[model samples]
Target: MTLYQKLKASGNPQAVAQITISLLESHSVKETAKILGVTPRWVYKLRERFRLSNGDISACIKKRGPKFRMPNRTPEHIENLVVTLAKETNLGSKRLALFIKNTFNIQLSPFTIRNIRRRYGIHCRKHKTLTGSRRFATDFSAFEPLQLWQIDAKHIADQSALPPEAYASIFKNKLPPFQFTAIDIKTRLRFIAYADSLDFKNGLTFMLLVAAWLRAFGVKHQLFFQTDNGAEFGGSAGSRKRKLIQKLIFDHWNVSLLNIPERNKETNCFVERSHRTDDEEFYALNLKKVTSRTSFLKMAQNWILYFNYRRPHFGKNMNGMTPVEALKFYRCFYHPAIGSMPVVVLDQLSNYTSLLFDISSLPWDNLPRNKKLLNETMAHYRHSIFSTSL
Candidate 1:
């Protein structure tokens, strides 16, 4: 390649301009053009710019495009609005455009929104792209709302998800240490409950509460709860205790407990993914403000309400609708109550039940009970029981 061609190929405009200026001092314009692989007229223009700018090599660099902004460019105010909304919502270009159009009656295209985001250094988080085979492998189109729910537990004291003060406050204030989460695959509708412990009793209580909440809303379909093979849900495969727990759920509530394959988390991806959202959008933002168990529960309830009824989701099956909106979109297949399921404190419910009936009176022969968990639960509720008696 020619010297100029090589300089240009280096993708450095400053280097190209300096080299062209250095060569112009010793070589004729025609000879310079020949060596630099350029027209004599182009060389003459660079020399003139160089002389006009008092021998500044930067002047020799060709300026591309129009000197003035395009008349059709987005208005400054509109671009500012897009940037503000992008920061506030962290929505992608397409969704931001749609939101802008719907909220403000503006007609900005996604391309324009994308450019504004790029210019402002605002970026949306990019999710991993699923392979075509894996993408189409599990078809959820045929699933109806309330048919399949993915349930999982999230440790709320995680440092990665909570601020330092919030993490410390979790222990200092004696807040619930675990969050039990359940999300429907069809509508992305979710329910959450907080607990002080991560034991079989709490897990069973969470499922029972969720099932009862759904049924109260007039849901008639037989529901399925998919969970990981965590000891909380049930022990690993072939454990007799796991079978009995599954049988208990089936017999009492007609809700089937399905365990994901051993060591394969992808099967419970729906609820697993929602845990990250809880960390980013819910816990991290509000946990720092929590001062007590009651305040934390209230904050959690508000977050769940906003998530189900107000926040828009752009997941694979959601199509940019909030969970309630998605449910409404499939109104024919969903009960209205499914959209408004309440969040509860699992420990409180378990404690309330324990107060009503002696723990030993219930069926416990077949299931292996944790003595430490049982004693801790009773002791935790002992104060409430004494207060109620007084």
Candidate 2:
């Protein structure tokens, strides 16, 4: 009900009028509503009644201010600065604002910088390095480097507080380094580097670098690059990368282009999970000290190399081998069977990683005649499997 209605219902009209006047004067509709135990709309109605009763108050009340203003300087220049800085270093609002203030002599609040970002609709995202939920994870297994590659990019956080040199030179321009990473799922060899741009050229260069690294390490196999449908992975509709992969890679190698469905593509689950090591080992220790992108990237590269070659992946096999060892072991002399499908146990997860083998690969003579036995054969691998709902 309106405050007028409330007052008319109340025995004390003068007291209600005084309280309403106090609330309108103080702009404390929330407090007044709580005291009166009424909605703010009722308070608003009271203000409108009083304003209508006194024409002088309505005529004197000023108009509300504008929500946005045309930026004093060129917005193009600021956008360029923001994009450059975000790419070179992952410094968020407070630092960006302070950097502008100290270096360019332009005093900007963090909120203003956020507004500037919103104005242009520039999004800067850092994929989280850890996973508490397994919803986005993928299921794939092939025990060699070229069998499959999981790819993604991460923005490395700038951990250092404002240093004099950084404020003077780098921060003045708003340039930060971006980290692009690709991981071979089977062998777990990582291709990680800090780059200034995330363009098609960079994507091609990253792939070439991985191919070169594999060749240099005497790793030879038909490569199957599996990645999300990121812009970098595939070019714009009917673009060069799309043509290149279709005409060249697919025609040449035993390529398998696997991607998470669009709905599940938001999180880069496998490689993102690998970033936990990047955080615990690299960023956590070095963030307090390093400011230069060059220095930080060098350290990051070294750590990633060590992780791929030395660090043991507890998830690969029940035998507990590093990814390299497991890949080599599988490649050299492992064979289960050729008839029906082999029972590949997934000991770690409660769920099944069902294999749909090519019927063409096996002989018809040894194949299962009974569908029930085939289903039971697959189920018997996992002790916890309750049904063949898989």
lDDT of each: 0.78, 0.54
If scored against the real structure, what TM-score would every candidate get? Answer: 0.72, 0.43
Cα deviation of 247, candidate 2, in Å: 1.4
Worst 10 residues of 1 by lDDT: 127-136
| Candidate 1 TM-score versus the reference | 0.72
Distance from true location, Cα of 341 in model 1, Å: 3.1
Candidate 2 stretches greater than 4 Å from native: 1-133, 136-146, 158-176, 236-241, 248-257, 266-268, 318-320, 331-390
Writing each residue's lDDT as its tens digit, candidate 2 over 1-390 gives 755568657875455656666766766888788767778886777677777878333433234577675557446777688667654545566656656666678766677677776766655544333334545533555345445677665555434323244334434333344556667665555666555555544544455455545544554666655566667556433454555555654544344455555645444566866665565455555554555545554655567655654555545441335555655666633221111111111121112211222223333233457978978877786645655555
State in Å the error of residue 76, model 2. 65
Best by TM-score: 1
lDDT of 1 by residue, 1-390 (tens): 777778878978788778777787898889888888889998888878888999788777868888988899898989889989999887788778878888999988889999999888998653222333332134687678778999999887887656677678788878888999999988888999888789877887788778878888778788888888888886765676577766644556778778788867777878877887877677666777878878887888888888887777877767678888887788745555565666677777887655533544546445447877988889979988999999
lDDT of 1 at 12: 82
* Best model per lDDT: 1
TM-score for candidate 2, please give it. 0.43
Give lDDT: candidate 2, residue 235: 41
